[model samples]
Target: MNSALEILTKYWKHDAFRKPQEAIIASVLEGKDTFALMPTGGGKSICFQVPGMMKEGICLVISPLIALMRDQVQNLQNKGIKAIALTGGIHSDEIIDLLDNCQFGNYKFLYLSPERLQNDWILERIKNLPVNLIAIDEAHCVSQWGHDFRPAYLKIVQLKEYFPKVPFLALTASATPRVKEDIMVQLKLDNPQIFTKSFYRDNIAYMVFETEDKLHLLQQILQKNPQPSIIYVTNRKSCNETVHQLESLGFTATFYHGGLSSKDKEKHMQLWMNEKVQVMVATNAFGMGIDKANVKTIIHLHLPQNLENYYQESGRAGRNGDKAFAVLLNNPSDILHAEAQFISVLPDKKFLNLVFTKLCNYFQIAYGEGIDEQFSFNLNHFCTKYSFPTLKTYNALQFLDRQGIITLSQEFSEKITLQFIIPSKEVIRYMSLNPNDEEILLTMLRTYPGIYDMQTAFNLQLIAKKSNHTENEVLSLLQKLKEKNIIEMMAKSNDATITLNEIREDERTINRVSKYLEAQNKLKTEQLQAVLQYSKDTKSCKNKVLMQYFGESLAADCGICSYCISKNRKKQNPETVSDKIVELLKIQDFNSRDIQKLTKLPKDDVIFALQKLLEDETISINSNNLYSLK
Candidate 1:
């Protein structure tokens, strides 16, 4: 058998194991239950992969993130290692074949979701495999206290009954102290060897700036740094808008969001990864399994839902150990906006019951049935039919998904393909004859520049909005054009797929997870409050604050954070700040905000300097409220 180090070098091409990885791998190899709490970018995968390679049989790895699972499987395959992931959207026959291969094909690893374990046939097949180690990625999901708790993770402990002697390795990048305890309890690890790496990244300078004009500040920061960076926004609309803003300012940037097609997502990701674009403006969906080491900056234009998300996102920078920055741009209005978007949309028990009942009724699922039944789901149509609030209904469905009640698949959603069958001149003539279709046709032409040449998958919602018509109206018009032979159109009207994982019991089903629902809602609220407090903080060291939150203590302040830098600036001679303000006034009229930006001083110090300059008669306030030299 190859040794752990030999396997690592042979497969991963890394000569040395990072600190603590060797020790954790050794524990797993010794047949002991292991728990690893490493920060993001800490190479947690190596702990399991190396040990799994050294063992004789295939390793069973379970993860909640389908994308991450696919990514790791692809990476391992690219390295000539045998690996397979049984994710969603796979045929049952193929799954059986994959499982059989795991049994007889000399496969080294099998990756699957925790939810897959609920199937008795899958469990029986897994029980028959010669599994050497059971690796659980994102192990924090097993804990109810975790930020992303999945009820399916509770079933993971049943694997121990199947493989009693197999050592289990559980790993996560973020888990609070309570969550850590919950993970060990829920996974039922026996005498688990625990390894925790400090969350502090000395190379990352955490920065928080309060500004009303975020775009202006963003421009300044990007211009000054000009390195490969990521700008995080809250939604798809903002992602595109920010990219446009950056491009207009002569910066190369691309955007990524959940709404993008898989092809577009890969295209944009490659553009940023190859440095064809200097920046990637994206939502939180962009960073999983991404290992770009030289990202110099991670800037958040909107407040994250919680500090865990912020830490995970910001930690993406400076993975190469050089100096980097994690910047958060906040304003007073952001607090209210975040609360509205995150907290207010949380569905309670009653709401969940309502959503579940309506969903079953909509699908025509009889009571105490509907297990394993799948249906194409049109969220907008359902919400419109029932007059349900769209956001809350979506949240309720997500809650059902997390609770293992239903499987919601958003893959390949919102796809509308169209191609002009007639010549462009004939299409224009048809459009002119049909005045009502003229606007929508023109909008489609402008939005998809290549529609005349080839079949194109376009965003129906975007076309509806751009054409100033309802989506139904746009679809109707497109259908008319298609019937007239003006164009060929195929619209996948369903935006998601819903699979019933359990029988429809309506209130009884919701009552089963009521306590968990309440607890999770409370936890989310507290997490948001903590994020708000962190953003409003001005005195504490940013690194120390983050470390303490994750159950680590720092004796000394990190001198690179925004707080430390401001503290050092305050110790400078007061005359220097006053001199800078005076020089700016001599050049032109200025306000306190303008002076603060130009002089790179804090607002308080800028105000103080301006007051002193005015008292000394070296500067005077003009009628326009701008300070000028007297």
Candidate 2:
């Protein structure tokens, strides 16, 4: 432990291991199968990383999130640790080279996506590597009942046979007991050490508001709360809509969702991280590896599919242990809409069969011939061409992924740049004729690596702008260099990573998977309705009810929520009109403009209400900013 902290200080700046991290690290080092249930900021990665540093062989980490894998690998490299994530989008030769590096180059960690388990050649290569530990991130996905279960996770269990002596460690931030048990069964853990952190977060206040006008309620929360907040809506369009609304309401807002281009997503994320954007309106796709510690609030415009998702998103707030609020804005129709979304994705067997045949046709493979072909799909365009419902077709594809028909990875793209292939001496010799051109060429050589290995993809316009040359000049120079065998260049296209299975699935198999998916969708709809039931319960504390749903028995009333406030005010006032007025004010401050925008009520009525408030001095408005008694 002394050497550990010394290395930690020498490299990572921290002197002590976070709570539960040391124990998990020690267990893994002792060659024990460990299952860790820690919160978001609980230092889960250190449990495997520290032990990997102390062990004799590499630790192969299986993660389900590509963005998370990229971020963690980059961070590890930044700390001078050797780590690699062999996910989709890379060429097959690159994967083979990385595997060879892991086996012979003394790489300590090789992070892989779960879908990569389907690659038999890669598995064969990994089977020969000296893997001391297998770490599975987001282990809850093994459970069918879990919120984000991926079918590829089940194939991970086969690696246990390849390395019988190696210990397996599973980790997840959110899971019910059922999910935990499913994880154990899926991984085939043998009396593994199970560690669970208490789910109770005493510092975060949970609040839910029932209202017809949610945008106004959202504005009120933002005005009163501190910065570095997140607002979650149901879809990409809603994320944009909410951001526009907030911007009009005089707040700095940016939107994010999976549908955005990778460059756009990264730009928005960087802006938010730099505090240039005070609030982000996004779908649930954001915030897996985002580690901003001072987020003060999370507002949900629609109910999440389950508590696991809600908890994971809300947990992003108050990570620095300060006070924060997790508020949900709900209307009666919101639950119905969420339910409809769940139902829309349950594909019928007929559609599933159609998708299977269409996929084979599109790839130009016969029924029995698509064994080793790799192809990318555009789901919306594919469905539009075939006249199938897009959402239902996507669901069917997911079912196919589950049935081992094909691997459908979530969409991801990254900005990668590289430059020329000549040795420095020859380049310098060529550049000695013109010092200015030599300087620019030498600058490219010094800044980027792996330039000589293959055709380099880079932005020609940016390079020309920096070099003060025309785009045509740059192109001609690059072309001349390539013809001289001094460089090779290939720009990256918008390519999706995918691998198809060898066997064509029969109609029977498709039908079986479809039935199972439909059943699962039905269960999800029911669970969502159950959460809505808890939300509508007026007799219980909102926090207590939510905690109880996650199996907490002694959870108490949260005194700050709408239900609690309403109860206390009802007992004191005994006047319905006064309580209604106060609740309405909590939703929004009504001035002439707000009233005119919303209601058909006469201006006299609105003016009378404002005068009454001014007379009592209970509220005031000036220059569109509203205020209540401080």
Candidate 3:
């Protein structure tokens, strides 16, 4: 195989592989199961991608995030590489055709979500494909102990038996030692090579300021560094609230969370990526697989659930390797609120059982009825209308879905139009013959290029404008054409779907799912509490604390950090004005006159401070007499 260096330069446009990527790729290329622990922005995708290119057969990548699949496939397509994403967005008939293509087509990679594994026909077809590698992304979800664990991921472990000799590569940007080992065991890797990278960024200055005036602090940070940025909150409601606050501050910003429709989410993402909006106030759901590298800052309006997530979010900043900041604006009550969030996940078995039962009934699935059906789900609306505890219900549903009861997708449904029908000339001639429908017919032809190349639906408004008609007129004409078989139209996405496994005779299955749900709640609560401890732990260096949470051991303090500065200042001097002034001068060099003004002491005291500073050589005065840090 060619060197990772050669691959890096030839395709990825990087001078060299990032830390651990080279080692990880080498291991996987040698046909070893590999577990890669990288923080966000750690070049995790390249580990599997580079190897996929070198291998002989298609690398089947299992990913939980559908949005990430679309983005990666699109990026690969842009590079003129053949890749496909088999997700819930496609129709059953199309999925069959795609599987056939993968089996015989020249596709190098196929990306799929974990939920798709439940299809028996798909699994039957997969066994015949020449799969060379199985890359499990976000592999932490396979572990019961992982924070974002999915029950659907358990089926992933069974894939090894089906393709016993195919090498496996499990990758994740966040995983503790416990989660790491769990991933290895769950994937059933045979003597896997593990690559763990240090979770530290030298250029990212960490700041957590206690503030009551959050809007003011946010305003100051945005004004100070008005580059691309993200403000992360904990929930959808909070996401909107934070965006509203940022908007009121005269900043152009947008909000993103799991709650928005796919169309709106895509529009906002495009706006942010296109630089039409400089800020995106969102929840944790927004950052994964987002390739915008110029994000100069990431502000945490709420405490994240764990350091793994915190590290990943913070690492998104300064991706261009420039000096940036990860600021946390918190209040004293933040810890309490955080702790309350944790407790909300610590519900009892009875509570979980009630919620699970409601979910099965809410979806109108009798025992074992929704084995493989998929449907769209709206979390907040579902919880509010049904008067259920949202966090508890969400946890319960995740547990139930994991236990193979249903598929709960936490993604927005997207709207897509395909103008994938008739050639432009053919359409124009047909419209000419029907002069009464000419305006609407020509609108579709003019607005969508797909009409000339493939069968597809065009955006109603754009088509209307082109044909010199209103959106309604265009839609009516399209419907008429579709009924006459002259064209076809399909709206993009419906909600998530859950197929009941068919009516089961055993009532004990309910108890099994309930126990798992209760256990999940407790685990999530513990994870959130760990975050609270990280926020309030005063006895340790903040950076060290974050490192330790990610399962890293540090030998030294970050000398430039706030903790280091605070400690060094306290040890230097307290009673002596000279030492205090010297330390201040070292931090920020000031002229003797400016020192005099800042100290507000007598001229003699200022001179004494300057004399002490000069004696210590902590600072020096220029020939212009402007003092500066040495």
State TM-scores per candidate.
0.84, 0.78, 0.76
242-343 per-residue lDDT for model 3 (tens digits)? 888788889989989876766688899999988898899998888877867788889999877776688888888988888888888788988878766656
Off by over 4 Å in 3: 1-11, 89-92, 345-347, 366-368, 378-381, 402-404, 411-509, 569-630
Query: Model 2, range 118-210, lDDT digits (tens) per residue?
Result: 878888999998898899999987778776676778899999888887889999988877788889998898789888876777778788877
lDDT of each: 0.89, 0.75, 0.75
> Model 1, which residues run further than 4 Å from truth?
378-381, 414-489, 493-495, 570-588, 597-603, 610-630
For the record, the alpha-carbon RMSD of candidate 1 to the native fold, in angstroms, is 9.1
Query: What residue runs in model 2 are displaced by over 4 Å at the alpha carbon?
Result: 1-3, 89-91, 371-376, 401-404, 409-498, 501-515, 569-630
Q: Each candidate: how many clashes? A: 0, 1, 31
Error of 1 at 106 (Å): 2.3
**Model 1 reaches what TM-score against the true structure?**
0.84
Q: Lowest summed-lDDT stretch of 10 residues in model 2?
A: 570-579
